[model samples]
Target: MSPLVADELAQWAQYIQSATGIYLDGSKGYLIETRFAPLLKEVGTTSFGELLRRTQVDTTGALRRKVVDAITTNETSFFRDNSPFELLQHKLIPDLIDTRNRSTGAVRPIPIRIWSAACSTGQEVYSIAMLFHELKVDLKRFDVRIFGTDISDRALAAASRGTFAKMEIDRGLPLDRLGRYFATDGQTYRVKDEIRAMATFRSINLLEPFTFPHKFDLVLCRNVAIYFTERDKARLFGSIARVMAPDGTLLIGSTETITGICPQFEPKRHVRSVFYSLKVNGS
Candidate 1:
């Protein structure tokens, strides 16, 4: 693979940022080449500049979609990081339920909506649903909804299918939970309809405007912000804050931070893990 010219690298950086808020620099030139090489060959282009030109002139936007999908990192596993789920199971869900129940006087079913931002292939969404099952929360008393959104159409399609390969199931998924929530067919496992029905998957770009129908009680934007520019990170979290309940919980990557990115969220640590909540003034 040849190195991308400085001009071509800058062009791609702008295209990627404009399309997905992902900032690519010279250091990532090899990544761009490796990810887009097949697409470039399939499109019969010999140069990155030619590929960019073709994508720009593509009226159907097919080339652009291919490029974006190829570039977006869809790396994830079921319960990829253990601490977050542990926190959710042992503390967050219980506390939230209690808070909501008290506010409503147990008069109506509690609504607990969660958004798995940059949710790749729906593992995290289903994982959250599985937790509810594990907790044996009464569905009649709670109207729970989980939404998994990602930038890749292919990833969303797989997520919507609710099927996972053996390796995918084995990674970060507990065997007991697997048997309880999934129906096995040979080596592959399919999430049971009950769990699948609790969640929805959509193709969403974090850089764009959000129009969710309801504000979320919990939002997980994990392990996905390292690719964004500082300016874009501020914009992304600002929009997220707007769609969050005043007391909603926000979870970013274990290594990621909103310290200087979004001021509305303040970090709270539970044991070894950390989560964020809306900062109340004068506290």
Candidate 2:
């Protein structure tokens, strides 16, 4: 590909994101060609520039969704990084439980709410379920609700299925955990029915609104905003701040730190990964 073609693809991605709130990460033109080339060829389009022109003129909305889904990175796996899970299992959960118990006295265990934003393929959310199960908490006793949301409907549907191929099941998942939590079915593995039912998956447009039906005690939106420009990052964190409860914890990807982007949250250092606590929010 020539430099000019790459540059035009980048521009088109920027336009798509700015117009439709779906980020393309600029480096994902290969994804566009890989996924859309067939459609483009089927439609008799020859080049990326021509495809872009067709997308602009065509208001049928099919091309837009296809492009966005193709370009959206759905890279995720079970127990993605051991350290973050460790921190959640050890540090954050204990602190959150104690704080909730002290704040709300009428219950045996206080309710805990969590959101896994940009949760691709549902592994991260399942990881959380395993942690709680390991803690020996009767899931029925404590009101625990986990919401896994992604911009891609395709991924959300897969997540809702609570099933994985052998390779995908093996990736980042320990053998013992897999054996206990998943049942082998022909060529694939499926999460236990009880564990799978603990989380709900949905399609969410994060750029549209900061409104969540309910405020969460913790939000894990890691690895989702790394490619956004500085200004977009600022807007994203601002939107997150709106939906977050005061004192709620926010975990981000290891490579991403909202230090300069969001000053309202206080950085809390943990052995696994640094998390930000909402010292203040849209009050």
Best by lDDT: 1
Model 2 residue runs over 4 Å out of place are 1-11, 19-31, 42-44, 57-60, 105-110, 280-283
- Candidate 1 residue runs with Cα over 4 Å from true position: 1-3, 105-107, 281-283
Tens digits of per-residue lDDT for model 1, 155-265: 898999999999999899888988889998797899999999999888889888988888899999998889998988988888898899888999898888888678878
Candidate 2 lDDT over 87-117, as tens digits, reads 9999888777667766745465456889998
lDDT of each candidate versus the true structure: 0.88, 0.78
* Prediction 1 TM-score vs. true: 0.95
Give the winner by TM-score. 1
